[model samples]
Target: MKRIYKISVAIVTLLAGCSKSGLLDKDTKDSIDAQKFFNTATDLQVYTNGFYEMLPTYTLYTDEDSKSDNLIPLSVDARVKGARIVPPTNASTKWVWDDLRSINFFLENYQKCTDDAAKLKYGGIARFFRAYFYYEKVKTYGDVPFYNKVLSANDPDLYKGRDSRKLVMDSVLADINYAVANIPKEVKLNEITKYTALLLKARICLFEGTFRKYHSLGDHEKFLTEAAAAANELIASNAYKLFTTGGAATAYRELFARNDQDATETILARDYNTTYGRQSVGYLMTAPTAGVYGIPKDMIDSYLMKDGTRFTDQPGYQTKGFYDEMQNRDPRLTQTTAGPDFSVYKETTREPVNLSITTSGYRVIKGLPSRDQWGSLNSYNDIVIYRFAEALLVLAEAKAELGTLTQTDLDNSINKLRARAGMPNLNLAAANASPDPYLEYWYPNVDQGLNKGVILEIRRERRIELFNEGIRWDDLMRWKEGKKLEKPMVGMYFPGLGAFDFNNDGKTDVFLRTDNTTPAPAGTTSIINVNQKRLTNSTSGNFNPMYSTPCTFDEKKDYYYPVPTEDITLNPNLAQSPNW
Candidate 1:
């Protein structure tokens, strides 16, 4: 499939985009003076916005929904059961290159500023933005170019290369350190800050060090230990506090809806609205009738109960239909997902709300605006880029990787997340259940009982806390658990519903997933297996050999998205990730 976007950034003549400096028009060397642009507040504001302009590329890394759904399969929540991505071509990779290049470009000239505060503030923001880009790159591709200054076309060793992932990590960590030391402690709701930089450092270090150690990267434990140390320091600082509310919906639904409320969890957010740019996660997830997006029925199954039972696992779970399935579970589920009974809207005197229950029976609420947000003035919500929940989860992952986490460790990390959602704290010792079974499922390769089930607990918190924030893909990757299912996509079928009987035939709905399959009555293209006697993919669309049902229980390699085609071309030196 053709990649869908290109950078609108202007390429100044006489300059070349540098590997380290990124995609600056490069006129800084012998052409336009960098000082001219950095001299005024107006210039500084406009210049600062250039970094924000590239934010769209970061989220656009997904591909077509079907017909070789590549990045999107991983980008969106399509690969849980067994979805696959199309091949990566040149166009798709350029975006990553351009995104990184934009930040490098900004930082290259940002230093030329004569004003001290502007230099620190603007430079801090630039470094933080650059670090953010590399963090994304590192998460997806392990190593990358670490350019900090403008490089000229004639510079020798133009071919002399990408630093090791470790080296890149050093660069990322250093920039974050610099940012924390320079920017203001209290940047306005609309701006980046010193605390933002430090918080970002906590996130990246935690993610990088934790993920590597979890996957057994070189010096794995060393990285994780350092990452955990970094996270704990942030926790100890108490510069930010958890967003807490007493109302039933105040726990999480409040933070999810109020984008800019500084709950201490949010590290940085991509601002969205009708005017400044908007988030259509709702439009993309809810059906057309909902004026937003809709979550498929398969995804809704991933939610676990307060007692940690899957809806399907609970006795008599299927009878109550979705309302009961959704009830008494995490309250965040209702806030994140819309059920048939949901009737929320702006207010009276407003046009009729055009929401539907969705063909799959779910709606997108998290990151969506109230009906009144449309038109005129922009919706002032911050698209959460980082939240404290991640810090806790990262720490949990780091501790688990170290295999040194304790009951108390799990309590503070994952259990606290569960408590936030009103679920019982996970207890490994209380019920006399050894964490061994969970660990065997998780770190089967690790020696006898070192993992101790902390990984699963970490995942549980993430699943409940980070839903609909575009985090699942990254999640499946770092955990290395996105592709366990053979058939990733499948249709949804109730026990006996939606079965089509052609010619008014009575017996036409049976299907199976093995060779020598049999087709049922007319119009029913299916067969029955000795194991499953009920309906199959006849009328319900559940028999795709390729697609995996959302939560059919899985883990796999197609989890990491293909580095966009455009990114590859911009940095041919960089290679496609394995299994992409």
Candidate 2:
């Protein structure tokens, strides 16, 4: 357990605030120093509060999904390209452990507090964050060294090798379990509670369980049971439920933009204040006008029809144009994208489809606020980190994977989410009878023989419900479906180079051409954009912006990120990840 004291001291002091004016004024009765800072309950709280910044904010949360199949970037990342050669000196390499030391320092020092209740409560907080830190590290680089306590500069344990995944995850489970049992039960806006710990435990356990099950690591059932039990505990608490106080179509969007004090669905959120300029670029980046990040046609095709039928099952589904295809689909589709009669600020209705705003025809509308509330600094809607819907998905998937699922369980978990969206309940018997063709194609790993149909449907529900919330990359990695990257990234469909009406509003929206010399149809109102290198094929008869070359993913190496080369050099005992 080697620790870098320079980084550790700066982080601990800034977070713990030992030298800050009034941080120690409450306990002037005792001497204030680095080692003596943990003498009071207030000290324990301030130290633990420092860890909240470790959680992902709104921008960071949504940006993560760009790496997955759900959202396509203006340009593909180097990590997602065909030949991902991550060097040892790559600046983006996530092969460090400063967060671990911050957490371990608290665990080692919180016990020094004389108050029993304060010690237990704050100790639980420390353990919970420790679990979070390690889970992220393991998810990024598998089998990292585990350290439970802060170490000195010359500690020999710092030279130790990587620990097994099982050993590290078991310790994570222990930490989360302690936090779940000892943490307070009060409902909070953004504070950790027993419910928070339970939801995280469910999330982490499900990830490990599915990873092991898919990668053939064994003992998957044990982790699945843990996931199920943790989710069940949170569900039984009766403190949270789906946000359904408004129309089903608008309910999902309102959940993200609402600033109400009572948010029933959200378990934990990263709050922001517009006046303080603590906002995210949710509107500017994801809006149809920005064009930086856009949702793909593959994700749009995944949504079920309003009647809960597969859209791909319809004849000529692939050939259907954008406006007609969006009709009678899931309500979430309309809410998520700029559909017909699209409006900002809920005032005027107009169809605005700017090709420059989105690479795919469909732009992101998930976190966009009203026109008056829309700005880089004024978008203060709280970003939800965890909510009850994830708990429902986790519970249902865990049970299905464990082969212990039933109609009653589906009714309790998946059915609740469906009802919120005004979609029909999923029938276990019908699902097991025949899995959807689209799902079977996308999630090829589910083809393995073990409750295939229900498992696939559960996965579908998870994707549809939690698409832009930034969990897709982890979901794909854990399920061993990274090969999805190889699929062609296509956008709005077109017959060929022609002026087409995307919104079907009796007006031309986009004018396609093989070259700038190609004239637009005489006097069309469509926006004339020249096609040079913008699309994969200027004359390929379809709209694919990123079709320069087909993408490829190496399953053997892409699953786990490479351990930084510099880190391996520093510690000769450390082994590089496979295929690095």
Candidate 3:
């Protein structure tokens, strides 16, 4: 609940432009305005069409996982490592009101249509976006001002202070509930529907519920119950399902790379086409040698064995080699990262010997494109935003945290995901008897109770299922587990930098020596630029690829961002978040 930044324009003076510069007004006769825009359902549709553009796509390649343990970038971010500073103004801040303004504009004008059904339908769409807009705001800054009306620059409400998070979330709940009731029941891959609204509602509720509970803010059950109810509604409807078009190993991989999104699982996705101006750089950004992206050794170790047993439980598990470590693990492990016999972009003929691309030796294969679609900065594959898999995880976690989860709940929610991954069902009693040490260390604040084991499992499932999808940072933040950032950002272990065959292709594919003048040894395909890449004790044996640098996480000051000084100066009613 930080007052992060001030709006550039003071609300009272926003509409003071003179007509000489056409600043006060342009010709509304030809241009779309509030009165002219919502006259017909077609007009309403066209106006709402802009809202879909606001939906996230992989094109915005700010992979937040880079800020967490899920993946490591070329360099550790100073901000994530307790080096952030408050900016002078809102200019450099991510906190923006334009998206809210757009949604509020539509909501204020969508009722011009006389047809009751059309009005309700379009209004549902507007409300859904409003809810989404506020959800992002509340999550990012907490206790943001809520507005249903499209405020003019001169509107008094523009200068109002921040509202309580509870009030804003209640408003969001109302909007989403209306959307679920009135949005069309018919499902579409790229468009929002009643089910999409339900999914968003569930996600929002689970986040707020968990956040309040972990932060010790009371009345958390209200949001937990809402989250559970929304997820249960979707489950009962049977309108959506986890995409299992192929076998377990390949199904998960295919879900991200398919030309079209799998309608069974994906409720709404941001679409792209070669001809369309909108294209995604996700593939290129994550491609080999594109950026120094790699998963941490800790994350790699979290994947369970094929039979749903913890890999860490295996004898000598920590000492296993790269290829050996990947064997017979969760099918998703092989799907998400390159494993033995892995090929480039699903092309069996193309061998994955590009060791230069992966810092951890665990190359990322999720969402990469085939040879045909592998242009430098082009990929038309849709980025899924809302999906049934996430809803299932939300249901399981929320129920577990509420302490009301039953074996039946596990059978319904977590079991389905495990089944899709070709793993066994989780046994509550067994998991408690031997909680995974890796997860317990990551979430050390959690109390050992009846729900502890199930909660840990749910967290693992959420991370593995949603890895690289931009959910980790928010999950950590809401759980008040930011201290995990201070943990070492370690990658695949190596005895020493030397020439070795990475893919076991019977050819030495990597020459990892530190000497720049040393030409790659015979048949080497990758070179480690020690000066450029991170490595723990680069000069010594037994090094980590990702933990070469030092970083820290300030438990108190780093949790919520601070409000800008200018904003607080402008409005004394505004207060900074705790400790900042």
- Model 3, 45-163: lDDT tens digits are 66666666557667433366776778776666665667777755666564555556655656766677877888888899889988988888787778777778655546676567889
Cα RMSDs of all predictions?
8.5, 5.6, 5.5
**Worst lDDT 10-window in candidate 3:** 1-10
Please tell me which model should have the higher TM-score, number 1 or number 3.
3
lDDT of 1 by residue, 1-580 (tens): 1111122334322222434323332334554456566565445545665566544422321112221211112123444444445445534343235455456556666566567787888788778777887887777566555666554455443324456788888788888878878887773444567766655776677667655754667666655776677666566666655566744344676676653556456655565544445444434433343232335444455566656655555665433444356666666677666533344433324122222222222445565556545333335555665566776776676776677777787777777777777777766554224443432443343333444454554555566576665566555455554333322332233443333322122444333333344444454443334232212443233322233234443333453445555445655675665656
Inter-residue clash pairs, candidate 3: 3-563
- Best candidate, TM-score: 2
Ten residues in a row with the worst lDDT in model 2? 19-28
Question: Looking at candidate 3, what is the lDDT of residue 394?
Answer: 85
Please estimate how well model 1 matches the true structure, expressed as its whole-model Cα lDDT: 0.52
Model 1, runs deviating above 4 Å: 1-31, 35-46, 56-90, 94-118, 258-265, 273-279, 289-302, 307-313, 316-320, 345-359, 372-381, 407-411, 428-451, 485-493, 498-580
- Of candidates 3 and 2, the better by TM-score: 2
lDDT of 2 by residue, 1-580 (tens): 1110112334464433322111111221222365767889988877777777678876654577777787777777655566666566635666656556667767767778899998888899889998998899899889988888655546777767889999999999999999998998977867888899999999999999999999899999999999999999999999998888677878887777665425498888877664434464555554444436768787888889999899989998877877789899888887777776566535566745665666766777776666655555667666788899999999999999888999999999999998888899999988988888788888898735557888888998898899789899899899998888887777766656667776675766677765566666554544534364244445534457676656788887888888766667767888988878
